[model samples]
Target: MTEPERLRADAVRNRAAILRATEELLAHHHPQQISMEQVAAAAGVGKGTVFHRFGSRHGLMRALMQERAQDLQTAITGGPPPLGEGAPPRARLLAFLGAMVELVARNKGLLAALGPAPVATAPEQEPREEHPVYRAWHGHLSRLIHQQRPDLDDDMLAHVLLATVHSEPILNALEHGAADRLERTLRDLVSGLMPEG
Candidate 1:
């Protein structure tokens, strides 16, 4: 490859290395505690490389979230029965909630590390609806609810359901040793809302 091509290839490799390091750290450490310097060291690159690629710690987290969200979106859109398609509306809704719980749980660790980001007087204060991952999730759940129970207020129900799976609430439950209980409760909540035969 030419010099220019080799340089471009190195950039790609560096970007991948940074993301991989961030992901591994996210699994075991809170986002706030894991600094850009640590990530650079873990990735075996200079700190400049990390800053050049991600810009900031928040940027890095956003990239990690998008990566995770893409995988989840793929599963929900075309992977298989229940989450994707080819199931009854009620069944699909249940499966969707189940899958959502797992997704939230995986990301909840990050929040556990964050510890009450942007604290609000009300429980519903945290709203990240504009993020692509969040927007896609909200749209999918809202659409599913509308399809099954047209009479109900779909927008309101969708917001509330998604709220249940948000990072703060999930992390709180996990902290209290109630993660399983929370999942079961979410299942029950969604199950109750499903339209009857």
Candidate 2:
């Protein structure tokens, strides 16, 4: 029995309302196009309430992304063969990359809302690695690639692979009717890297 096990009523209601409003707004607009003020108004709560609940727009986006991201993470860590445990390195790697493509596509609007940090031109520029989603994907892919080829720099390779799914490229693919080609493209890339059995 803990705090969440006890479950406060108002907190539950507020959380539900906020999430519902977020989903509604996100359906038609990118995350960056919306704001805390808009979310508060849509949620029927004060701005303070929004801040209290989610800290910032980034936090709100992260909370929304977490459920979907967690699903992919669970599959990679424990779900089943090919995507999870007990699969050959190449199979699992392909599955992981494919899953990433799906996740990015599904959350296209959210990623647009949480774009890559602006290029650093000054001391006041924000941290470059602020997106938790990218960090998670990179870490997971690094581990998988490292297991396959210790001779390669897995971290850099992971960055390069994940870069393929960045919002700019993905959104372009979607517009040019080439989005369906992404998974196959990744499959070919990974196969070329790892070579066939």
TM per candidate: 0.82, 0.75
**Compared with the true structure, what per-residue lDDT tens digits does model 2 show for residues 5-99?**
55676677888789788988998887778889999999998999999998989778767777567778888878988998898777888988877
lDDT of 1 by residue, 1-197 (tens): 99999999999998889989988988778677899999999999999999888778866766666676788799888989888888877777778777766665667655444334311112343456665566787788888888888888988887787777555655677666665777688778877777367
Give per-residue lDDT, candidate 1, residue 4: 100
lDDT of 2: 0.75
TM-score of 1: 0.82
Task: Return the top candidate by TM-score.
Answer: 1
TM-score of 2: 0.75
**What number of backbone clashes does candidate 2 have, counting pairs of residues 3 or more apart or in separate chains?**
1
Query: Which 10-residue window in model 2 sums to the lowest lDDT?
Result: 116-125
Name the weakest run of 10 consecutive residues (lDDT summed) in model 1: 114-123
lDDT of 1 at 123: 38
